[model samples]
Target: MPSPLTHDDPQAFGPYRPVARLGSGGMGTVYLARTAGGRTVALKTMHARIASDTAFRTRFRLETDAARVVGERYGAGVVDADPRAETPWFATEYVLGPPLDDAVELCGPLPEQSVRALGAALCGALGQLHASDVVHRDLKPSNVLLTAYGPKIIDFGIARAAGDDRLTRVGVAVGTPAFMSPEQASGQEHSAAGDVFALAGLLVFAATGRPPFGHGQAADLLYRVQYAEPDLTGVPSSLVPLLAQCLDKNPFRRPATDWLAAELHDGSGEFADHLPDAVLADIGRRAAEVWQIMPQRLLAPADEPDMAETVAPARWSRRRLLLTGGTATLAVAAAGTAGVWAWNERGGSGPDRPPAPGPSNRLLPRKRLDSIWQIQVDEDDLFEEVMQPGQLHVVGDMVVTVAPHLIGVTAKTGQRQWASNLMDSDWQVATDGERVLGLGPSDEGASSGKAGGDPLLVTSIDLLTGELNDPQVSLPEFNGELVGDQLVCTANGIAYVVAGRGKFVHSRFTANQTWYLFAVDLSTGKRLWTTPLPARRSGSVRLYFLSAAVVGRDLVALQEANDGTVHAVVRDTRSGAVRWDRPLAGVKASSVQLPLVTDARHLYLGAGELRALRLRDGRTAWESKSSRPGRTYGPPALKNGTLYAIEKGLGMVALDPGSGRVKWEEQGGQGVEADLKAVPVIGTDHAYSRRASKLWAIDLSSHAPTDSYRTTGNRFIAHEKSRTVISMGGNFLAAFPLR
Candidate 1:
C-alpha cells in the first residue's frame, strides 16, 4: 500500500512528479511517480550523499543498462532515465501487479499449468539477459511480479556482466540468502547458469509456496545453498525432475533458458489463461486502482514547539492518512518488492560491499566424517584492500591466516597451535615454507592506525608457540607503523617487504609518504637491496601491491597504481630490480589477490585468455587450444607438471605446461559451469574445485568427480602430508579429504 509522502520527500524530481514513497534503503529511495501526461512510473533515486560517490553512480548506470537489457516483454519497460542527474535516477513503467510473494500469500500456490507458463516467460526473460552477457544475480519471489501478460523480474541492483568483476570486491557475497545460487552464496563467480538455478528456486516457491532452500538467517541460508539439497516434497511430480535439473549444483548441468522454456511450456495458451482466476482478478484490480491514486504531501514539523506538541496527539491526523476512504486501499505499483530492496550496500560499494560483522552468523567448529574438521577464524578487519578477505597460507603441517593478527592451525586436525595479536596489520606478518617472520615491537601502539617512526625490528615466530624470536634483524632506516607497508613475500632465505617512511597519519595512506621495496636475508639478518616505490594519492584505499609471491629467483607481483590500473611486474629477488612490467589488462587487481600463478619457467594467467609468459624475459607463450573455439577458460591452476583450468563448455581440462596441448579433459561431472574465479585445488589423486555449495573431488583415474563434500569455503589449498584440503571462507576454516 502507498505510504504518505514524508516532509523530506521531493515533490518533483527531474521530469516526473513523485506520487508517494514505494520503498527506501540505506543508499537510495524508490518512489511512485508520474509524468506531465499522468503516466505512472517507478522512479529510483540515490540519496544526495550517496549520489556524490563516483563508484555508486557507475553501478546505478549499469543497473539502468541491466533494466533496459531485460526489455519490455519480460520486465517493466524503461520509460525514462537520467542517472547523471544531481540525484541520479531512472524511471520504469509502474508495474500494476502484485509481487510474486504477495500473490502467493493471497491466493496460495499456483497449479502446474500456471507454474509452466510462468517458468517459460521467466526463461525467456533470463535468456534475453544471458544473450546480452548479463546475469540477474538476485532472482527471488519478492523480485518477481505476477501480471496478465507474464511474470516480470525486478530489482536489478545486483545484476552485472557475466564475468566482469572489476567493480566487485574479493569476498563479499550479495543477493538474497534464501534464493542465491551456490557459487554466489560462497562469494565466487555466478554466470548465466547461476540464473537458471535461482529461477528454479522461484518456480519451486510458486509451486510449493516456500523457497527450495527454506528460510533462515543469512549464514544458514548461505551454508544450505552450497551444501544442502532442495526440498521438493510439495512440488508437482511432472515438474519435479525438470526443476531438479535446473537446481543442479553444477551450473553446466542446468538446461539453457531456451531449452528450459521449451520444456516448461509449448507456447500454446495465453499466460493469463493459465494463471488462477483469483490472481487475474487481483491484477485487474491493481490496474484499475492505479488511476485512483492522488498526490498527498505531509507537512513538516511546526516551527513553534507549542504547535508541534498540540498537533502530535491527533489520531489518523497524526499519520496524516490523506487518501482515506476506498481510495486508500490502492497500493503503490512498486517496481520491486512493496518498497523493500536488499541492496546490501556498504556506503560506496553497492552490492560489492564487504560483509558486516554479525556474531550470530558465525560458523562454529564441527567434528564430522563429511568434513575433516572446521574451526572459526577472525573476520576481515586488517584493511579494506590489504587483508580484508584474510589470506590463507598452508606451509608444512600448518595453515596460517593473517587478518590483523596471526593464527596457526594444524592442517590435519584443524587444531589451533598458536594465536597472537602482536601482528596487528597484514604487513607485520610473513612466512616461508618452513619459518614465519614478523616486523614489530610487540606493543599495543605498534600497529595502531597512525604511521609512526618506530624502530623496525625483524623477528621470527616460533612454530611451537606464538612467541617472537627477537634480535633477528633491525632496519634502522624504516618504521613499523606505515599502514601502506607490506611484507610482500617470503621464499628460500629471503624476506621481501614494501615499506614507507612517513610521520603519524590520520589516514591509511598519508600524502607525504615515501615508499620503497626492499629485501633482507633472514639467516644473516642483513639488508640485501632497497628500491623506491611510486607515491600514492591522498585517501587512496588500494595499496601498492595487491598480491605478490616468489617464483624461484623471480619476484612476481600484481601492483595497483594510483590511476587504479594494475600491472603484472617481475622483479629480481636478489636485487629488487624490475626485470619486466606490463599492464594486466582485462584483470581486476582485487579479484586476483591470490598468490600469482607461476613456476620456474613461466607465469600463467587467465585474463581474457588462458596463456603464459616466460618468466626469464616475459615473452608470450603458446595459448591453450585444448577446448573448442570461443570457449573461455577459468583461472588456470598448475600442479605437478600439468595445468588444470575450467573450459566454458568442456569442464575441467588438463593441458601440457610447455605447449598448452590437451593432455586430458574431464569426462563427467555435475555441470560444465565450474567456478571461473577461484583456482581449483590440485591433489595427488583428485582435483578439487567448488560448484554451487559443494566441493567436488575429481578422481584422476576416471576424470570425474566421484565424491563431493558440502562447503562454504571461498579459498582452497591442499595439505599434502595430511591428505586433506584446507578451505577458508564464510568466516570459517575447514579441512576436507583430498582423495
Candidate 2:
C-alpha cells in the first residue's frame, strides 16, 4: 500500500494527479498517480536540491530521453516526461509488486528454478536495453520490481547511452558502490558489459539472499569489486559456471545478455512458477488492489485486441498492462496462483528438438581406395602410445603429420626423413610449400599445465629438412588466450599469424585483451611487422580466432569477438597494414568455425550462407543463400569454376563462382544420408566429400552420385594440387589417388 501524500508533495505534476507516495530514494520520490484517462502510473520527480544542480539537470534530461527511446518491453514504459520542469518529473506504467530485495527479505532465498527464471527474465530486459545502445548504470535489487507477471527493471535515472562519458568527466563514479562493476568503481567508460556484471550481482543476491561481494564502505566495496572473487558457495552446481563467468573480473570474459537469456529460458520452468506460495499470494493481492483502484474506463474490452495493437500502443490497455506488470498479475487473472506447485502446469516445449528422421534409402555400395603409399606407426613409438593424431598437411613433396611431435615424410617415397621435438597438442598448423608454421603451446609449456602455459609459442620448421627456424616468437599468457588455437597462413615466403593475448583479470567493463596479426619472414624467422586489431567491448565469453588464409598475397582472417561480432579482416602480408575490416553479412561470429578459402581473386566463406569477397578490397563479390539458410554448415570449396558445399537440410550445392547462380543441387534420397565431415574436394569430373567412415563421390555435370569409397578412419586431409588424399585411422596413414 502507498503512503498518504505528505504536505510537501504536490497535488499534480503536469497532467498526472498524485494519489499517494510510492517510494523515495537518493534521486527522487515516486508517487502513485492517475492520468486524465484515469490510468495508473508511477510519477518520479527529482529531489529539489538535486534538480537545482545544472549537471544533475542535464543528466536527468539524457536519462529521460534514453528511457523513452528504450521503450517499455524490458522495463517500465515511459509514458511522459518534462525534464525542463522546475522539479523535473517522468511517469512510467505503475508496477504493483515489491522490489526484489524486499521480496527476498520477506521470503528468503529463491529456489534454483525461480532463480533461473528470474535470470532469464532479467536477461531479456537487459538485452533489450543493451540492444538499444543503452546501459543501465544502476541495476541493483531495488531497481527491479518482482511483479506478478515477471520482473520489471525500473528507474533509468542513471542509465546512459553506451560509451557516453558525460557522467565520468570528473572521474566521479555514478552507480551505487555495492552493485557497481569494476569499471564503474574505477571511473572508466561504461558499456553493456558493465550492466552484465551488475546483473550477475543481482542474480547472486536472488539465489543466496546476499550480494556476492557483501557490503562495506563505498571505497572498500569498490576495492573488492576490482580485486576479489565473488562468493558463489550457495549457487547451484549447474548454474555455477555461468554465474562465475558473469562475475569474471574481466568484462570481456562475461557472456552477453542475449546469450544468457537463451541459456536461462531454454525450456525450464516459467519464472512465476518459481515464486513461493506466500510471496505469490502477497503479490497477487497487491495487483488486485491496484487493479480495483484503477479506473474501469481504462480497462481493456473483454475481447483482447489484436497483437499488433497491443504491441504498437505506447499506453497499454488494462489487460495488456496487467500482463506487462509482472507474473503475479498473470496468476491472479488466470486463477492459477498455485506457486511452486504450478511449475509443471507452465507448459513450454523443452529445448529445441532435432529434425525428425526422413524415410530410409538403400545404402550405397562401398568402394575401395587405390592407395599410392602407406606409413604405419610403430606401436612402441610415443606417437602411437601417447599422442592423439592431429592435422595432416601436404606442402610440395613433403607430407607433414602433427601429433605429440612434428614428423616430415617424403610424399613420393613415404619415407620419414626427420622429426622435431615440438609439441602439437592444442596447436594449429599451416603450410605454404616451402615452410610449415605451428601456433600453439611449446613442449616446455605443455608439461606445466593441462591446457598448456603461455607464452603461446610460435615455431617455424623447414618442410624439407624439418629444421626448427631461428627467432621463434612467444606471446604473453592470459585467460582463454589462443582460444581454439591461433590461425596461421603463409604466402609469398611470409607467414601470417592471428592470435589473441592480454589479461582480463582486473577490469569489468572494457576488454583487457588485444588481438594481433603478425607477419614473419618464413626463411629467417624474423618478424616483419605486427598490427593490433581493433578491440571490442568486453563480454562474458572469450573471443576465438575462427580461421585465417592468405589471399592474393594478402592475409584474410575471421575472428569472433566476445560479444558475438564476427570480423573478416584483410591485411597486406608485406607491410601488415590493414586493407579492410568488415563484419560478415548476416552472420554471428560464434556460428562459423571453418577456415576461409581463397582463389586468386576472391575469398570464399560459409556461415549460414555462402559469401565471396573480392581479394583486392574485401568487398562482397557475391553471396549465394543456402536453400535451408542456417542449415548450411562447413566451408565452401572451389573446384574449377564452381563452388561446392554441403547444405544442412540439402545435400550438395554447386554455384557459379562469378555470379553466385546455383549451377546444380542434390539432396540425399529419403533413406540415404550424405556423410559430411571434411569439406568437399574437387576431382577431375566429380566432387569428393567424406562422412565418418566413407567418402562420397558426386558427379560434377549431373550432380548425381558417382561412387562411395570406404575409408578405415573418419579424419582425412586432401591435397588438391597433388591430386591425392590421405586418411588417418589408429596408427595407419593411407594415401589414395583422386583420379
Candidate 3:
C-alpha cells in the first residue's frame, strides 16, 4: 500500500520514489522507480563517483542531446532526463526482450537468413540516426536488443557530437575491442562511417560464434584493429560482400547509411525469390525422414509419460557353454519366439493352460546396415567434449569413432559394441583387416623412455564374433606403418621397431640431417635400415602455405621466421626427410591455419596467390594472384576441379586450381570495413558463408542463397554440410537442416 523502497539504500528525489536497483554502468546506476504520477519508469542516475565532475556532466548532456536529436528524426523519444539534478538520471522507453548478447547466448548463433534480416533492420535504424547527424560511437552486440517487433540499438552514452572533446583519452579506450573500428582504435574522428565499421565487427560475431579477432586480451584485439584486417573467415556468405564494404579502412570510402540500408534491405534484386520449390521440398523431406526414424522424442519435463526416465529395456537371460576345454560360448535367443512356435503349431500346450515360463530372453531386432546413432556424451550438450568429428573407420560391421572417447559401434544400428577407457588427449586410431591400432603416448609419458611418447598399442578382435584375438603388439614411441606382413614403429624420426613374427629390425636417423627413410619389423623393438636426405621443421609439408597440399604420406607445415619469411615445408612420412621447401610470397601480419587438399599430382594452396606446384620437384605448376586487397585469411574451398577462395576484405573468387586462372568472380561488399572472413564451406552444388551472426547457404550453380537462415541473434561460429548445419555462440548449439 505504501510507496516501496527503490534501491537497498534509497536516495529519493523530489516527487520520485526509488524502488529496486536495476543495473550499473561506467557512468551511472539505473533504478526501477515510480514517479508521483504513479507511472513506472527506469530512472538512470549518475554514479556519485562522477556526479561532481563538470566534464562528466558535459558528456552526459551531450549524450542526452544526441538521443533527443535521433529520437526527433526517427519518432523514438528519450522520455525524461535532468542534467542539472544532484545525481543526474534519464529515462528512455523501456523495451522488453533480451540484449543481443543474451539472445545469442540463449539461442546460439543466428542462421544466415536471420543475420541478413537483422542487418537490414539495424541498417534502417542506422540510416535514421545518421540522417539526424547522430553518431553512435560504440556499437556492439551488448548494446543492441531484439524486441518483439524488431531490433533496437540502445545505450548512446558514449556517442558524441561531430567535434566534441568527449573522445576517449590516451589511457582509456572505450567499447569492446572486438567490435571497435580501426579508426576508433587509432583515435580518429567518430563519424557515421565508424558505426558502419563497428557494424562489420558485430556482423562477424553474428556469423562466426567468434569475434573477427579473437582469443587474445582486449589490448591485443585493439592492436589488431588498428594494424590488422579483421578475420572474417567464419562469417556467412550472404553478408560477406556487404560486410566487406562496411569494414573499409578509410572512412571516406564507406557507403552512406542510406545506401547501406537499401543494399541490405532490398538485396539489390540479386537474391529475389531465391527459395526454389525443389529446395523447399528437399528440406521438408529430410526433416520428415529424421522424424520417422526417431524411436521416441526427447520431450521436456512436462510430458505425461516421461519416456526419457520411465522407459526401461527388457532384460534377457544368457547361458555359456564350454567349447574346447575352457573356451566359452554365449548363446542368445528369443524365449517368446521358441514357446509361441511350440504352443500353436506343435500343439504341446494350450494358450490358456499357463505353461511353465521358460528363460527370460528376447533378441533385439536386427538394425539397418547404414544406421549411425551418436550419443552426446556431454550432459550440457556443449559439444566441447567433442572437439572435432573423428574419422569413421569401418571393418565389416564394426564402425570405430576416435573422438571425445574411443568407441566401436555396429554400423547397422549405431549400437556400441565396445568402448575403451583411455584418457588420451592427443591420439589417433588406425586399423588393419585383422587389428585396430591405437597410437598414443604410453603411461610413462613422453619424457619417459619406458612407455615411449608415441606408443603403438595394437589390439586384435574377431571381425564377425567380436572376440579378442591372440598376439597383441605393444611398442614404445612408434609411428607404425604397414609394410608387407609387419607393423613397423618409428621413434624420434630416427629409430624403427618392427612387430609380428617375433622378429626385430632396427634403423636410426641418418647423420646427414637431411632426408631419411627407415624399414623396421613389427613384433620386436628393432630397426631395419635408414636412408638419408634433409632436416625438416615440424610444420612444413608442401613448401607452400595456403597454396599447396601435402597428400598421401607427406605432412605440410607453415613456419614463420624472425625475418618475416614464411616457409612451407613438405616431409615424407615413410622416411623422416624433407620432400621440398619453398617460400610462400606474402607479407602476413598474422598466420591462419588451412587444411590441405590435393588431387595427387598437383599441390594446391589458397590465399592471395592461388598456386599449384609439382609434388615431386617443388616446381611451380601454375600461379595466379587474388583480386582482393589486404591480407588473405581464408583458404579456398575445392570441389571437383574448381577452387573457391572467399578473400578477406573481398568477395568470393572461383578459379581453376590446375591452371590458376579465373573462371568467375562474385562481387563482394567492400567500402571501408568490408571483407569476406567467413570461409565458404562448399558442397556438391552449394556453398555456405557464415559471416558475423548469420548463415548464408549459396547455390554454387547460381552463386546465390537458395534459402537462408537468419532473423536471430549474432552468430559466433558455424559448421555445415549440404543437408545439415550446426552453429554455436554465447550458450547453446543451434541445429539447422539445410536445403
The candidate that achieves the highest TM-score relative to the unseen native structure: 1
Candidate 3: tens digits of C-alpha lDDT, residues 45-73: 77767988988876776666555544421
TM-score for each model: 0.50, 0.42, 0.35
Sorted by lDDT (best first), the order is 1, 2, 3
For model 1, the stretches where C-alpha displacement exceeds 4 angstroms are 1-369, 381-388, 425-428, 440-452, 504-506, 624-629
Cα shift from native, residue 730, model 3 (Å): 41
* Residue 733 in candidate 3, Cα distance off native in Å: 48
For TM-score, candidate 1 versus 3, the one ahead is: 1
Off by over 4 Å in 2: 1-389, 410-418, 440-458, 470-487, 498-515, 534-544, 585-591, 616-619, 626-634, 648-650, 666-672, 712-715, 720-722, 728-732
Please provide, for model 2 over 1-739, each residue's C-alpha lDDT reduced to its tens digit, 9 standing for 90 to 100.
5776654466577657777777888878988887554556788888878977978877776666555544443456565565646688887767657788988998888888778777877876676566445689899999888754567787777887666565566467878888888888888876889988898899889889989899879888989998998989888888888988988888899998768867765634444566787677777666557544532112234585422111112212112222323332333222111112111113521112212221111111111344566554311121211112345677777778753346676665555665443333345577766667776654343233332234556677766556666666654432222342354666676766655554323222136556666776655756788877667565323233556777665777776655566778777777888788887656765444444677888888775678888878878887765333445545677877788877665667788877777887874451145444456767787777665466777777777776766676445666656677776664445666565
Considering TM-score, which of the candidate structures 1 and 2 is the better prediction for this target? 1
CA shift of 706, model 1, Å: 0.9
Best by lDDT: 1
Error of 2 at 433 (Å): 2.5
Candidate 3, 321: how far from true, in Å?
Answer: 99
- Say which prediction, candidate 2 or candidate 3, comes out ahead on TM-score: 2
